[model samples]
Target: MADKIRVLLAEDEPSLAFIIKESLETRDFLVSIYGDGEEALAGYRKDSPQILILDVMMPKKDGFTLAKEIRLSDRNTPIIFLTAKSQTSDVVEGFQHGGNDYLKKPFSMEELIVRVHALLNRLELPVNHKEGIAIGQYVFNYTRQSLKFNEEEEQLTHREAEVLLHLYKSRNEVVDKSVLLKELWGDDDFFSGRSLDVFITKLRKKLTKDDKVLIVNSRGYGYKLLC
Candidate 1:
């Protein structure tokens, strides 16, 4: 059997942390859950995991701070920030501090698993890989978090980047809202649902210049990224 993907999850919420840990473990992932960023960082130093799931607000140290430290030690290990903060500045700060992905609160386990697998897949790719995906006339540089339309480059927020990348990867396919919520937010509650709607609106406006790119709403079903 292949080695299980090791994950270090740091969240102050006990119930939520338990759910996330159990969900990941059920998928054969070796998970170490911590309520404090300091403790999680300690465990990280002792034995680095394949990925780190961090909550933005925590005691001792925050996710952003820990991420910076982790980056200093290990640049390649993937880091996913789990937070309730949906502000554009907060999202930008997360990516600036080296967050590989960001998930808002009220996400579902299913969505988390999908993102985990996606990050792992990207990490497993060879270093020389440089294929930039084309979304309409824009070239999305997933590694650099830059979207280029014609000669203009737009820097995407962490959450925006994750959402866009996932959509691009699932091109011409229907991406269920529940799946996206579960993967990105960890819970599919009302607030997160609203948050997802806001992001979808923002992304739609940003990609409006390209008539070929469409984020079709499927009413009760979910969303479809049609090219």
Candidate 2:
């Protein structure tokens, strides 16, 4: 049999955590469960699981902080944030802090399972190759999801890499706002649009090493990546 897919689950509520742990275990996953962010961080360091399901509210570090920490070292692992906060800003914050997906409180096991499988499928790109796309002063490796400038390397989330790659493909042209959103996020709705803005901001920051490289916004239409 294939090795069981490892999963790290950080949830503070004992009952809810138990439910999540047992559910994933039944699905042939080896789940390392932790009750707080700090413990979860340790579990992550030790297990290096393929998937991480983090509760937004936790003792010590919280899911957003934990995700940020993990992104610092491991950008490829998929993170699904569990939270009761439904505001658009909260959603943006989760994405800003490196969450790949967000699940609201009281979600169904079936939906969670589908999300887990979906992320695994979506983010299974090959990595660590040396080939890179020359983008001004930065070398962006889509496979590795990293942008390197001189000696420093900025790790990008899978979504960010995807967006950057897409923009690069159509550099110097205005990529329609709706088109980019629909292609990347599978939705061009207001919430997803907001998330896209956050990603664009992050990419702009990383590309700031070379001021000539810019993602210029075309009001009422789209964006153009000028390199």
Candidate 3:
């Protein structure tokens, strides 16, 4: 049997944290729980879990502080913020402190699972140069910043590549516009919002050859890449 993946979960709400821990354990994850960020950080230093699920607002230290402390020594471990903060600034701060992903409160278990797997995939894959990610008929080369479909190849700008990679990773699921803006642009200003629209249009045109692959606008909500 393979070893279970270790998870360190820190949240002040006992009931919610318990539910999350049990759910993850049932999925064969080895979960260690802490009620405060201080304890969580200590556990992280001692046990060194493969991933962290931290509440942004916790007693003592706080999730953002813990993340920064962890990153000071080890930047490889994936951190996911389980926060109630939906503000663009808060989300951006989460990323700046070394969070790979975040889930706002009142979230579904299914959503948590999807985000976890997405982060895990990036961690498990070899760094520096991955072969590519296949999206229907298109092959996206991350290192080369190019998308290829049959005989055609299109080069992508840095921002375009970043946006496309996020969409591709969360393919078939709607990713909130605010989430993308925070992760990529660091804020949800008017200019960045317009830029995202432009990038989406460019991506849609590039994948025109593949009828099964498309970036779908979720009508005032977000976008979903259907592949």
Candidate 4:
């Protein structure tokens, strides 16, 4: 068998932590569990893992602080935050602290596995000219949060950039509305649904400069960006 994917899971809730650790281990992942951020950070310093799964509300040190510390030493390792906090500011802070993805409480094991695989797939990709994505004629530099078109440049807001990146990743495939809502906004409530609609509309207008770009809505399904 291939070497297992190393995961540093920092979660204070013992029951939930055990559940997550066991689930990942069942899938052949090598999980190093920690009950607090301080211990997790110490473990991180000793042996950096391929991925980090952190709970936001932890003792000794919060996940955000630990993430900042990790970011200072490594920028490419994928970090996925698991939290119960659903506030927009909290989610924004997670990303600002170098989180690659976020999963709210009550998420299924299947969803967790899917997200972990997706992050790993992204990490395994080669560092080449194709590192970023192109939406129609607009060049989206994910790392820089900038979009350029015909010598004109526009900076995307955090939400806008995240939505665009997810759309680009799905490419020609239909991205389910629920998936978009959950992945980007961390919820599928009515307000989040409306917010997603607005962002999609804005992205469509931004890419309208190129006639080849189209963000097609699927009614009951989701949206697709075809170039």
lDDT of 1 at 29: 97
Ordering by TM-score = 2, 4, 3, 1
- For all predicted structures, in order, the TM-scores are 0.59, 0.72, 0.61, 0.66
| Tens digits of per-residue lDDT for model 1, 1-227 | 99988999999999999999999999999999888989999999876799999999999999999998887756667888998998867976787787867788888889888888977876554343246677779887766666789998887655666678777768898888898877665557776687678878888888888999999988778888888
What are the per-residue Cα lDDT tens digits for candidate 3 across 191-213?
Answer: 56886898799888888999999
Q: Is candidate 3 or candidate 4 better by lDDT?
A: 3
Which candidate number maximizes lDDT? 2
Q: After superposition, how far is residue 64 of candidate 4 from its true place, in Å?
A: 2.1
Which residue pairs come into collision in candidate 4?
Answer: none
Over 4 Å off, model 4: 72-75, 86-89, 106-111, 122-130, 133-138, 141-162, 169-179, 182-187, 194-227
What lDDT tens digits, residue by residue, belong to model 2 across residues 54-171? 9999999899999999988777788999999989889878877877788889899887888788777755544533378888988998767889999999888777987898798799
List residue ranges in candidate 2 displaced over 4 A: 126-138, 148-158, 165-188, 198-227
Q: Evaluate all candidate structures by whole-model CA lDDT and list the values in order.
A: 0.81, 0.86, 0.82, 0.82
**Candidate 3 lDDT trough over 10 residues, lowest sum:** 121-130
lDDT of 2 at 122: 58
Which pairs of residues have clashing backbones in candidate 3? Answer: none
Q: In angstroms, give how far residue 105 of model 3 lies from its true place.
A: 0.7
Model 4 residue 65 lDDT score: 93
